[model samples]
Target chain A: MDILVCIKQVPDTKDIRLDPETNTLAREGVESIMNPFDRHALEEAVSLKEEHGGTVTALSMGPPQAETVLREALACGADNGVLISDRAFAGADTWATSYTLARAVETLGGFDLILCGKQAIDGDTAQVGPGLACRLDLPYVTCVQKTREVTADSIQVERMMDDGYDILRLPLPALLTVVKDINEPRVPSLKGKMKAKKAKIEALTAADIGAEKQFIGLAGSPTQVVNVFSPPPRGNRTMFSGTIEEQVSQLVEQLQPYL
Target chain B: MDYFLTEEQQMIVETARGITEEKIIPQRAELDEKNEFPTSILQDMAKADLFSIIVPEEFGGLGGGCLEIVLALEELARGCVGVATSFAASTLGIFPVLIAGSEELKERYLPDIAAGTKWAAFGLTESNAGSDASGIQTTAVLDGDEWVLNGTKQWITNGGEAKIYSIVALTDPSKGARGASIFVVEDGDPGFSYGKKENKMGIRSSATRELIMKDCRIPKNRLVGRRGTGFITVMKTLDVSRPGIAALGVGLGQAALDEAVPYAKQRVQFSRPIISFQAVLHILADMAIQIEAARAIVYAAARHIDSNPKNMSKASSMCKVFATDMAMKVTVDAVQVLGGYGYMKEYPVEKMMRDAKILQIYEGTNQIQRNVIGQELNKEYA
Candidate 1:
């Protein structure tokens, strides 16, 4: 089986800065780290590859610097790193990003499984994973907390919900957007780091992936961020401090409006 | 500060730093309070391949040298000197094996040590053999295919926890220093036993115990290298590890400074932040200056030992003396900077100060290192 893990490089949230003038992220000075959520996805992919014999390829779509995350993935046991980077792929929203990734996946050939984080920390818009799954027309599961089993033809996973979890068995060649509860990521080994340093990353451009000129980049995106700001603090708020049972009854009384 | 480390070197630092932050730092206070062993933290380090940094690549390691060990130790000591001491001492034990063990012995043990499955320890400093290692009373006698060892090894780091020990024993007491040999003693050997764990003033999380060998018997092949070269191997091991101890000094000093700066900035005394006061500010300045200087020399000494193995005594002793002394000063001053709060257990500087003292005392005391350096100078000038 060939497992593909999609990762995104985002600013280290601890040192985030927002450009006041443009209300956009201050990317120039921010340290870039692999998205925390994506680390779980990558870890899961590597773990799967380790348990069952397979090749794990780390796939990323961004600027050339994004190759660092790919390298980091390799150091954490990924067998290959494929970076789909091109200047033309800039300013892409989730829709355009997913389209470009799908095209890149198609160009890279077939994979038995594709894993992705539920959302990127910066964007927080989770459309890409499901959108990519829709584009590839594969059975997909979101917020997978655990993998019960993985066989040649099928995979059983526990999908997390607000109240409980659901067990779902999907056929092979499926897509999964995993949650942090899935696994803990490992620090890279010395041999893995050495291998990462020496390994050649296969870089693909938009043209290389056969992405259409109209359906890619910022121009192709239908949605745009009009403004970004913290909403003003609401004035009317009640603080509830008591034991759980007392707090719940108080909350119920306060919420006893239309009901 | 910018040592222009290669990418892989930076990765080692980053990984060690990650382990320090995520693993050691959080548990350091608890470990110190209880004088508990840091087995879980050590295992976390093992998982991160921290143990493999110094072991040769042929034995499932990264084939790094003194510099790599220094880099990792600096980061680790910054988090918890106790944890770092346990880690560095294990390497001290491994050095004898690497330097003197036969190929068959290396093959038998190096892989496991490299993989962090089995821990190693060096036993050179006995109660009587503090400065003059020749004073140790341990003796090993050849009996058929086995060598029987007797006497106790004092202050043995990783004593009971470690599986392998490279201990010095006199094979021919008449020849004095030249009469001794090094041998590998397994933990479960017939007469090998661990004594009471010592309650130390600092680095309390690290285990310090005694190895009591009462007619301990081991196969003759367990002998490390040729007979009568045990002290020679011991010197080489210290030559490699003194720089590591120096790096630990730099790390501990950096940690003290890390604790002090934030306190100085926020500590409002005399109607203003204490940092605004010249007296308080200058201490910070001196701390930074000395730490950087020590760090520069430690890095240089480590690289020197890596590239120049035979004649590292001068460089090694210089660093071990300077860095460790610098740590003692900085950590004490860090406590001074914190003033009343610094002396309190709520702050880490008091602990840092305590940890700093051992860096100068152990791994060859500063005075002894100065003596070694002076002796080297005499040899050069003669």
Candidate 2:
């Protein structure tokens, strides 16, 4: 089982600040961490490789500094790290990201499974995994909560739903965008850290991956984030002051139209 | 303020810091309150390869030196000295083996310690043998193929929980100080048991119990280094370990200062934030200055020990005195800065202050350290 885990290096959301004037995220000086959700994806991939047996490759598409997350992944158990980084991939929306990642995946072929987080913390956009699956024409599952069964040819998983969950099985060479409930990630061990320090990461460029000029970078994306800002604080209120039972009846009567 | 650590040293710091943030910090208060040992956290550290930092690579470790160990100690102590002390005491136990144990002994014990499957502890302090270490009454007599040990070791860190212990006892009482010999004893060995656990002022999460070895039997091969060289090994081990204790003080002082500055800025007293007052400002400034100075000496002392490894008692003692004393003063001021809130258990500064006192008292009391330094000065002048 050769697994490919797609990860992203995003500003640690804990310290993230919004630039009031620009209506955009102010990333300068904030620490960069592997997207929290992607860690679950990597954990799932590594565990699968551990239980069965094969190589686990950590794949990421971002700036050269994004190599940090790949090294972290390698430290956590990934056998190899492939970073697809190019200046041309700047300001890419979800559509362009999926395309660029698809091209990179095509370049690094023989993966029995590809894993990704349901969404990036910074963007909160959950479209890339499904879009890449569409591009590769592979069967895919999203919000994978548990992996019940696995074999060389296929895998059975529980897909989390709002109220319950759905059991689904997909054939080999599939894609999975996992939820955080998949598995707990392990800390990097000394042996693993030593290995990661000495290991060489393979880097792929835009041209090397054969990405077309019109369908890659910011120009390729159809969707645009026109503005990003926190919603205005609401200031409307209706007070119901009485005994517990009286307040409950009053609250219900005041909310009749909405109900 | 940068100590200019190498890449490998920085990695040790970062790895330990990760464990501190992810594991120790969250559980520190509860563990301290309950006085519970950080057994699970130690396991987490083992998984992180923290336990392997100072052991020889041949024995499944990184073979790191004093600087590396101190770096990790500072970070871990920042989260909780109780946990760091438990970790440091194990290294103290390991030192006897590393410094004097034969190839056979090292092969037998260091691997399990490095793996973190079995923790180690050092036992030397008895109720009667504290400041005057040579006064211990524990006896280990040879009986054909075995050695039988008797007497109690008081305030032994990691006492009951640690699987391995390296302890010193009298082998030939007539020889006085030279009569003591160090031996390795397993926890499950017959006739060896732990007495009552101590309720301490700080670092409550680390276990401290009496090691009671009543006619405890061990094979002759368990003797570390040579016969009757136990006192020498004890000195060398303390010489090697003092810098780590100093690092714990620096880390504790820094944690206290870290709490003080932000608190000063936010805590309102009078018309504005208390930091607006000169008295509060001065306290914060002093804490930062003292912590940085303490850190500098600890780094220098550790670096000196790692580079030369000889004639280090004076340098090691200097750091132990300076850093630990600095920690005591700084933690007190941090509490004063926090005022009534700092004295309360709700804030960590109170806990930090409690933890700071032990650093001054252990390894070598600040008074004992001054004596060592004074004696060294007389020798240098002579």
Each candidate's iRMS in angstroms?
1.6, 1.3
Could you give the fnat of all candidates in order? 0.37, 0.37
> TM-score, each model?
0.91, 0.91
Docking class of 1: acceptable
Compared with the true structure, what per-residue lDDT tens digits does model 2 show for residues B1-382?
7889988888888888888888888899999999999999899888888899889999999999898999999999999999999999999998999999999999999999899888999999999999999999999999999999999999999999899999999999999889999999999999999999999999999999999999999999999988999999999999999999999999999899889999999988777999999989998898898889989999999999998765999999999999999999999999999999999988999999899999989998999999999999999999
State the C-alpha lDDT per candidate. Answer: 0.92, 0.92
Looking at model 1, what is the TM-score of chain A?
0.91
| Deviation from native of the Cα of residue B189 in model 1, angstroms | 3.2
Give the C-alpha miss distance for residue B59 in model 2, angstroms.
2.4
Residues A177-215, candidate 2: write the lDDT tens digits.
999988766677767777898999999999999998888
Question: What lDDT tens digits, residue by residue, belong to model 1 across residues A1-259?
Answer: 7999999999999997778899899999889999998999999998898899899999999999999999999988899999999888998998899999999989887799999999999989988999999999999999999988889999999999999999999998999999999986777766678788899999999999999988899976998888987667899988888899999999999889958
Question: Scoring only the second chain, what is candidate 1's TM-score?
Answer: 0.99
| Worst-scoring 10-residue span by lDDT in model 1 chain B | B301-310
Clashing pairs in 2: none
